[model samples]
Each structure stands twice: as structure tokens, then as C-alpha cells.
Target: MKDDNLGDSLEYTTGAEAMGDGLSRARTSFGKQPVLGILALVASMALSIGIIGLLDAELFATWVTFFVVICVPVHIVISMAWELNYPSFSRKLKQPLKGAFFMALMLLVAAAIAVTVHYAQPIHAGPPTPFVLMYVIFCVLVTFWFVIVWNCWPLSSLLDNRLLLGLGILAVAYGGGYGLFTLLFDFDAMSAAPFYSAAMDPGGAFPAFHVLAYSVTTVSVVFFCLLFDFWPITLFPILRAQPLMGLVSTIYILGLSAAVYWMGVEWLDMEPVKLMVNVSIGFLFGSLIPLIMFEGKLFGNLRQPWKGIAQCAVAVIAAVTLPSIYWELAPLVSGPLNSGAPGYQYEFWMASALLAMTFPIMVVVGKFLDFWPLRFAPIR
Candidate 1:
């Protein structure tokens, strides 16, 4: 009887192991197909954009201008949350659908609150309550749809794994930095108030400029240059080191602002002090916040602190100088500007210049900085 029982127990254990292995293999197979995920994402974004365009073309244009800027951060936040709490929702609900629904619901609630808080006026305008309610509802629905699409889409190929840490960094740096700026500069009256009014006025040039500058220059710098591949990660090796990675990246970003100022003065014929202040503010939103959030993933693999700092300094100098040179030469290829054009020429020029700045810097960094001496230079 004892021998028979032992045999049965071993059989049961083997069967369980086989089942677990099969499940793991199935998940791996599903996760590995990134093409399918990208297709899904494209389809979802198209559908969402189409719906919004039908409702309000101007607002749709605003979103299109900042599509990457808005989507990447939201995707990072959601993906991080999903990764950290993986399988809990799936197991508890006995399916992936329930888990997805739960995530969508949470995001919807949060989005509604944020939209209402940001948009709702304290003084009652005519039928303000109904308008606020409708806006909140719309925001919630959009957020819910976004969460669903993100979860269903496989973004592992496009984004880094340590996104949670990145999200935390953004929340602290951009959120905190913006708050500080507002307090110091009376941002609400000077910028925010005007921005809010302009955003509502679809026909206004200020609206276009506001969205273009914020999205293209400030937002794109962080999203593409730092988070995406537009700026080579090799430019800043300290991004991978521990303890001081965030601090160092922040400082390097601020220093890069000075370089941008120099370019604005030399190439764009802009005022030095104004450029310095503007670029510094831009850095707070663009490079500094994003680098601290996304690039700090390098810290986990870092071993040497001093070498990281040295590499970071070199990166700052290279980032500044290379981009400055590009800006100076960009006008040769740029066609004549139509001053009477409906859109703001300066906004377009700035966006073009910033985009141009990324390519040359990326080429230089990727070609020269990826070699062994630099590759192993980060020490940790």
C-alpha cells in the first residue's frame, strides 16, 4: 500500500510541473509577438483619434500634435502598474478580461477626477455643472479605452521593463518642478491662465503655438530624446549608475539648457538671458524630468560612481555642442518662411530646429560613443 501511494504522489507532482511549464511557455509565446501588439496599438489610436476628430477637429489636432507626448507617459504608467501586480488580477478573476476591466475602471476614475479638477471653474458659469459632468464622463471613457488598448497591446518590445521606477521619477521631477515654477513665477496668471483661454479658442494662434511648443519642444525632448531612441543612451552613461544617477542626470539636463541658450543666441539671433530662462524651463519639462525617470534604470547595473559622473559631464558637453552646430546650419536647408501664413512661423521653426537637433547628436553619439572604451567606460 505504501509503495502504491508513493508512486501516485510522484505521478501527481510530475503532472503539476508539466502543467505549470506549459502555462509558462504559452505566456512566453503570446508575449513574444510584438508585431501583433503594434498593430493593435495603431488601430486603437486611429479609432480614438477618429472619434475625437469627428467631435472636435481642433482638439483632435491638439492631440495629434502631442500624440506621442501624451501616449508614452500614460503607457509607461499603466505598463509599470501591470508588471508589478502581474497575475494577481488574472488569478483572482480567473481570467485576463476581468483584470483588464479592473485596470480600465481604475484609470477611468482617476482621469475623471483629474480632468474635473483641472477644468472645472470655481464660479458657476451658465450650465457649468452639466458641462463639467459631460467633460468628466468623456475623459473617463477615453481613459478606459486607452487602458484597455494598452493592456491588450504588447509593448514590451517598444518600452523598457523598469517603467515603474521611471514613472515615479517623472511624477516627482516634472510634477514637483512644475509646481515649484508655478509658485515662484506666478505661473497661473502669466502662463496657465492665458494657456487655458487659448486652448479653448480653437481659431487662436496662441493655441497652436502653445500646443506645438509644449508638445514638440518640451514634451518631445523627454519622450523621444530620452525615453525613445532619438537621443542615444550612450550620451549619458551615468544614467546607468546608482545613488547619484538621478541627481547627475538632472544637473546635466540643466547644463544642457545653457547650451541651448547659446544656440538660440548664436543661431536664432535670440536674446541670451531670455533664451537661458526659457530653455531652463523647457529642460525641466523635457530633458531633466524624463531622463531622471526613464534613464535611471541604468543605476541597477552600475558599479562605479566616479566614472559615471565623468561620463555624464562629457555627455552634457556633447549634447549641447552638437545640437548647437546643427541649429546654426539648419536654416540653409529650410525653405523660405511665409510671414503671412496662418500658423505661427516661430513655433514651426522651433519644432523643426529641435527635431533637427536630435538627429546629428544621435548619429555622433551612436557612432563614437558605442565603442568599447566608452561602452565599458561606465564602470558599473
Candidate 2:
């Protein structure tokens, strides 16, 4: 009896040790290859773009409108779901019910905006049955893609007490800026020839509001989730510092805007001044506005006065030189896509490709650059 009991205890200990080792190995394997993960994400996005591009012009426009107005908000809800269920930090909201409420509120607001815009320009001719069926298929495909590839783990740790604050800031900055600009200027005339308009219009299939919705949704998602939550870059030791991270993040976003402008000019035939304005708006929404609103929460912990000052300086520098840098690099990266040949007609495809090209650039910056002022300071 004593020998049997001893044997049983030994077997349990051995099994437990094996399980622990297996879990450790699994974590190391998944956690180490961020570049691989990013590449996979890029491929998935490209595939989705390709698939979505197959729809006819009108159907395509409608699908994109739906995606922009509905799917984008759904993505936000999904992110909030992750936060509620699988929070990675101590500061996150603990109550699932509260998280659900926030999610519901966000969706409701987004839906309200979408419904208002859609009704404002009601389609007198309802879409064909085939078109509706295709649109449903496209939505299904996009949802699967988002769930499988874009539902990143980094978002689980991205929030803090400042999330609601950040959301408020985002709303005021975007809403106020857009409203003020439209009030003061003829946006339709100014933006008529812009790349965003061309892409969103896609043979003049959508109204100006549809274009606006698409641009806002795409920019918000790309900034808040994709770029901000870029794991490989965010994990870099040098970039873990507050000010340095802020600077690099700002530069990266500007670079992306430049790339978009380049594509707009080379592929979509957008006017330079118009593209400039668009890029400026993008920079405002994606970088400057968020920075002011989040109070550097997007860049992680500051915990120092000097860090705040440095971040401000970087922001100013980025704002001043953004145009010059955009013009300089626009041609270099835009050349390949131009090639004196017609590029992808669909806007989503071009946008996806441009985004993919930027990923490698981001990886290079994250891997090689050491911008931290104190070389010996421990990485956050």
C-alpha cells in the first residue's frame, strides 16, 4: 500500500512538470516571432482586399459604406469585449456588465451617426437582390478576416483609466475639427480632387458623406488599433521610453500618411494641394489630436516631467517637417505602384497594399533604431 501511494505521487509530479514545460515553450514560440505574425496579418488583409474588390462598382461602394459605418464600430466593440474578458493589466475595468454597457453605447452612437447620414441621402432606387446577397457575403468575409487576423492580443493591455477620456478627446477633436472646417470652407470643392475622394468615390458611386465615413473609419482603426498596437514596434526596448516612443510613433504615422499621399498622386491622380490637405487632416486625427486627447496614454507610461517636454518637442518637429518629409519619400515608395500602368481600380485594394508596404518599414524602425536618450535606462 505504501509503495503504491508513493508511485502515484511521483507520477502526478512528473505530469505537472511536463505540463509546465509545455506551456512555457508554447508561450516562447508564439511570443518571440512578432515579425512573422505581422507578415501573416498583412497577407490576410491583402487577401480580404482582393476578395472585396471582386464586387461590382455599386455593390462595392455599398459594401464599403456598410463596412465603414457598421463594421468599424463592431471592431471597436470586439476590442472592448477583449478588454472585459481578458484584460492583461490591473487598471482595466473589472465588471463585465460595465464593459458591455460601454460597448453598447459606442455601437449605438456609431449606428446613430450612420443611420442619420444614410437617411440624409436615401437611395431612391433600392439595391438589387444579387447586390444585397454579394454585400452580405462580403460582410461575412470581412468579419471572419477581422476575427481571425486583426483581433490582436496587444489590445488586451492597451486601456487604462483614460480610455473613456481618450474616447471623449477623439470625439471632440474629430467632430469639432470636421465641423469647424466644413463651416469655414467649401470642403466639397477643396476635397473633390483628393485621393481619398477618388478612392471612396470609385467611379462616382458614393456620396461625399460615404467617403467621409470611410475615411474616418479607416483612419481611426489604422491609428488606434493597427499602428498603435503594433506589437513588434511597441515591444522594442528603445521605443518603450515615453518621449522617444512618442517621436517615433509620430514619425511613423506621418510616414504612412506620406505613403498614402504618394499612392493618391501616382495611382489615383490626386492634386498635390488636395493631397496635402488630406494628409494634414490625417495627421491631425491620427497623431496630434490623439496625443493631446490621450495625454500620452497611447505612448504608455511617462512618469517624468522631462518626458512630457520631450514628447511636446517631438510633436512640434513632426508637425513642421511632415510636409517636406512626405514629398521626399512619396516618390520613392510610390514609384513601384505607378510603373506607368493602371493600378488597382478599387480603393480598398490600393489602401491594403499601401498598408502592407508600410509594415516592413515599421519593422525596420523598431528593430534597428535606438532613440532613447539614456542608453542605460531600463526599457519599460
Candidate 3:
């Protein structure tokens, strides 16, 4: 009986292997063409550049800036999809496709977001309703795509280029630039509005708000892949090879902050430095908290990025709210310095000190709880 069961199991396994091989061959054939993928990417880039020029000719000149900020992310995604979907796309064109496709898709997504925002009614410089829904759909689809590809044919096992760096740079530049432009150009725009909409102000209307959404999407996917251990880049050799993890994480955090502050200034229509002190305090402390706890582990695993993110969000909230509470109660505490010019200085120091204390505590708590079983959980 045992021998019969073993024979049956072997036959089933062989059938499954054959089926998988057939599917892989089909994907490989599709990938080998490169023309379909190439055309799609190029079309996307052309559309993005045209829109940017149309939106604001003076602020943006030539195609270089647009290429870097607008074309890059689209290229990354398109390339990633094609490369990872390989044997379906030509390996010879894989790396080139990554750069090309990223640029093109980035443009397409940017254009789409802009169109959505431009036509939509403004609720204080926020993302258009359609874009928001589309953004969600895009994320879900990409995420699903990522999972299927990773399981079916892991790209990390094959490709090892600087593709991610290009992706990161583009994501940061465009996302950050869009926010800065919005802040400087529009007042009464919600501080968080650009994050949702990406670009609200006409000055930075080319790629628009949804562009940031796309950047977030790409980053999330890459990060998710790393989290699942599909990526050797997330580990030791890559860690030392260029500190890619640190660089990406730091850029993302800082870039996002700049974008947020830029929006806040615009939404409130305040001066460049109106909230300078407050924002600086928050940034300094907020940045530190992550460094303290997840410094080396920032991209240690896939979940580390998200975990660091959660910590950063918590820090920002605490930084903003806690300071307000402290300021309000300062008078009641009744210290000699509380009423003088030095009082402001004292308050600043106090807040900074408080933030300093809070970060390590968060790390410790995180370590103790292991992020509540989410740490060991699989990406799925």
C-alpha cells in the first residue's frame, strides 16, 4: 500500500511540473518580443512630457527634468513587470526595459493623475475623487501582480542591477518637487492634500498628485518583495555593497517630510518659515526615533520598512500634539523662565528632549512585542 501511494504522488508531482514548465515557456515567449512592451513604455513617456509642458511652460523647461522626475518611475514599473514576467519579455532588453518602461509608465500615470485633478472640483487642493479611487485600484493590482510574479518566477533570483536606485531617485524627486511647488503656489490647500492628490498647484501640475501615489506604490511593492525574502538585495552583500537600503529609506523619509511641509505651508498659505521651528523640531525628533530603533534594520527585512514607517507616523503625531499640550501647560507650571524670552528657548529644548526620550522607548517596545506577531508573518 505504501509503495502504491508513493508512485501516485510522484505522478501527480510530475504532472504539476510539466504544467508549470509550459506556462513558463509561454511567458518567456511573450517577454522575448520586447516590441509590445517597448512601444507601450515609449508612448507613456511622450504623453507625460507633453502634459508637463502644457501645465506650466515657464517653471519646467526642456525634457531632462521631466525625464528624471516624471519618466523614471513609470519606466521602473514597466521594466519590473516585463523583466520579472520574463521569458515573456526578452532578457537582452530586461535592464534597458526597466529604465525605459519606468520612465514611460511614470509619465502615463502622472498624466492620468493630472487630468483627474485638473478636471475635478477642488476641495481645497486635494486629489480628485477619480484619481483616489484609481490610485487604490492601481496599488491593489500592482500588489497582486507582485505576488503572482514573485511566486511564479522570482526576478531577484536573476537580476542584480542598480534598477532600484533609479526608481528611488525618481520617486523622491518628483514626489518632493510636486509638494514643494504646491506649497509655494497654493494657499488653503490641505497640508496632507498633496500626499493624497500629489500635485495641487498649477506650477507643479505636470506630473500632479497621483504621481506621488505611484511612487508610493512602486516603493511599497519593492519593499514588500524584500520583506518576503525574495530579494537577496535586502540582505548582507547588498547591505554593504552600497547601503542601498539606508539610502532609499532615508531619501523616502526626508522626501516625504519635505513634501508634507511644503503642502502644509501652501494649505495654510503661510510664509516659508512660518512653521519652521515646529516642523524642524518634529523632523529632527521624528527622524531620530527611526534611527534609534530601526537604524540598521531600516530595510533589514521587508516588514522593517513598514514597521519603521509606522514608528515614524506615530512620532510625527506625537511630536505635533505633545508640543501643543506642553506649550499650553507651560504657564501653569510656573517657572521663572516660562514667562520670558528664554521661555521659547526652554520650550524648544524641552520638546527636543522629550522627542529624544520617546524614540528609544518605541524601539524597545517594538523589540519586546516583535510588532505583535506581524514580524514573522509572511508578506501574503
Candidate 4:
């Protein structure tokens, strides 16, 4: 949100209006009807589990890369540009049509990105980790700067068309993300890997996962804090104002995410990659379900610190519980899970499945489907 220079246009919404955005349509639908919401989400997630379970380790990574390269960023675009208002076509359509049309839109965009990555071969490295981190983690990191932190300011006033505005944000995402990626991440940490090299896997300023972990943690903060009615940050109007708000929030959160990630890496006995894949992502999935799917109704009456505290507990619960579930399902889905390189490739595959594959499925079900069958289901 900028100064009064920004206003709500048909193309996009800006300023404080962007605050708690996407909540009304998706949240109210689910918050008011939790049972229905759970039904829809359970159905969607089961399908996701089945699909991931089906793919072998190597194929799963490829599938994760393709799906994430397209879907994760596409969903972010939907949130930032459309504010989760899919099928922005002038007229209305029915259930599957509306959902199908929206999905068609997603697939089309995914196709475009897929084509680019196919031809460009941005990261011709050994695996999709570098590329995926750049595209999904780093790219979206910058996108978060504009869409969430910066409130599309400057651009919000400058660009009138949503498509143009979205494109503008994406330009910054890729461009800034490139610089940030090279600056913050390094794949040479994987020096043990066969693909290690100076050009493609050339190490960055920090170990790749250092930043990756930070970036992922940054995302978690977005869920429990800014998205939670811009809490704590909202307490200070001066800080909440654009530019400064974005600047301060971004820096402080980066500091916090780094600390937390490093601490876990140093203290925990578990494999860092496995811990990151299971716990970090598990928390993220945990955060998404309550916010986007359950619509934060579990503690609707609570205020920020307490509410956020409750949600944090919920996130932890999910981080601990869900991964165990996904692990149990993993063997069934893909026969056996791989631990790491030299044969095992389950970690990255698992990450992609969680972030790229399963995340999109959940969003499509909750947001695009509008909680469909359950929403339409009859009350006894």
C-alpha cells in the first residue's frame, strides 16, 4: 500500500486495502463452514498423495520441477495480481466451468513457463534444486517484496492494467531474484555431488540452503505475521506504511529466519536437508491449511499475539504430524524413498511434491473450487 497515490482499480487493489486481502472470498466460505472445508481439502490432498506416491524418485524430481516451475509461481501470481480472484473474465461461469477455466488459465501460464525453461535451460545443472530454488524460492522471495511487503507501490500507481502490473512484478521477481540467488546461494555446497562446477554450481556468497532456509522461513513469517492482519507490525502505522514497512519488515524477518534456520541446523541431529524438507515445508503446509483452508477460524476470536501464538502452535503441530504421515504414504506411493545423493533422491522430490505438486492441488481445491462439493453439500 502506497500513499493516496494508490487506489483500487479493476485491474488490482492496493494500499491498506491489500491488507487481509484474499480473506473474504476464501476465508469466509471456509471459516463459516469448517466441516465442508475439511471435506474438500481432504479429497484434494489424498489425490496429491496418491500421485506423488506413484512417481519414482527420479521421475518425482522431474515432475516436481515441472509442476513447481509452473504452479508455485503461477499461484503466487494469482494471489498477488488477481488477489485469488481467478477467472477474472468479465462474466460469471458455473462450478467446474469456472474452476476449469481458472485452471486452464493456470495451465496456459504454466505452459508458457514450461516452454521457456525447456528452451532456455536456465540451470543446466545436475538436478532441479538450484533451478527450483531460484524460480520458486528466490523468485517468489522478490515477488513477496512487491505483492506483500511493498504493496506493489510505485508500480501500483504506475501500472493500471493488472496483467501489466503482474508482469512488472514478475520482471522484478526474476531480475532481482537472479541477483539475490547468485548473491545469497551457492550449490558448490553440494561439492560432493557429481555435477559440482565453477559456472553452474559455482558457490554463492552464502551456502545455497542458508539463504534457501532463510527464504523458506521468511515465507513462514508471512503466514503467521503479515498475513495475520499485519499484526505487531500493524501496531505501528509509520512502520506499516509502504517502502519503510517493506524495508524494515524484510530486513528484520531475514535476520530472524536466518537465526532460526542456522540454529536448527547446528543443534538438530537430523539431516539438515531432510529436516528442512519435512519440518520447514510441513510448517508451511500447516500454516496454509489454517489460514487459506480453515480460514483461521480455529481461533477466530483471538487477537494477534495470542491468535498468532495459537496458530504457531498449530503450525508446529502440523510440522511434526503431517511429515510423519507423508513419510508413511511415501513408501506406498513410490515403493521406497531415497535419502540423498549416490542413489537416494527423495528429499528434493519430497520438497517439490510438498511445495510444487501438493501445494497447487490444495490451492486449486480451496480457492478455485470454492470449497465445491462441501460448499454445495446439504446440511443435516
Best of the candidates, lDDT: 4
lDDT tens readout by residue for model 1, 1-380: 10111101100121113225342212332122232222322333334333433433233223222222223233333333332133344323322344344345434534553444344344433322212222322222222222222221222223334344334433433354333322322212223332333232223233322222222232323322233322233347654332233345334443544455446767887543234224532332233221321122323344334334433443454345534443343334443333222433333333323322222122122211211122223322
For all candidates in order, the CA lDDT equals 0.31, 0.34, 0.34, 0.62
lDDT of 4: 0.62
Cα lDDT tens digits, model 2, 316-377, are: 45445543443344334333223211222223223322222222222112111110111112
Instruction: Between candidates 1 and 4, name the one with more favorable TM-score.
Output: 4
Backbone clashes under 3 angstroms, per model: 4, 0, 22, 3
Instruction: Evaluate model 3: give its TM-score.
Output: 0.25
Question: After superposition on all CA atoms, how large is the RMSD of candidate 3?
Answer: 21.0
lDDT of 4 by residue, 46-112 (tens): 8888777666666666645665556666666665466544335512455556566667778887777
Total clashes in model 3, counting residue pairs 3 or more apart in sequence or in different chains: 22
Model 2 pairs whose backbones collide: none
Model 3 misplacement above 4 A: 1-240, 243-254, 271-274, 283-302, 333-380
What is the descending lDDT order? 4, 3, 2, 1
TM-scores, each model vs. reference: 0.39, 0.34, 0.25, 0.83
Q: After superposition, how far is residue 243 of candidate 3 from its true place, in Å?
A: 6.6
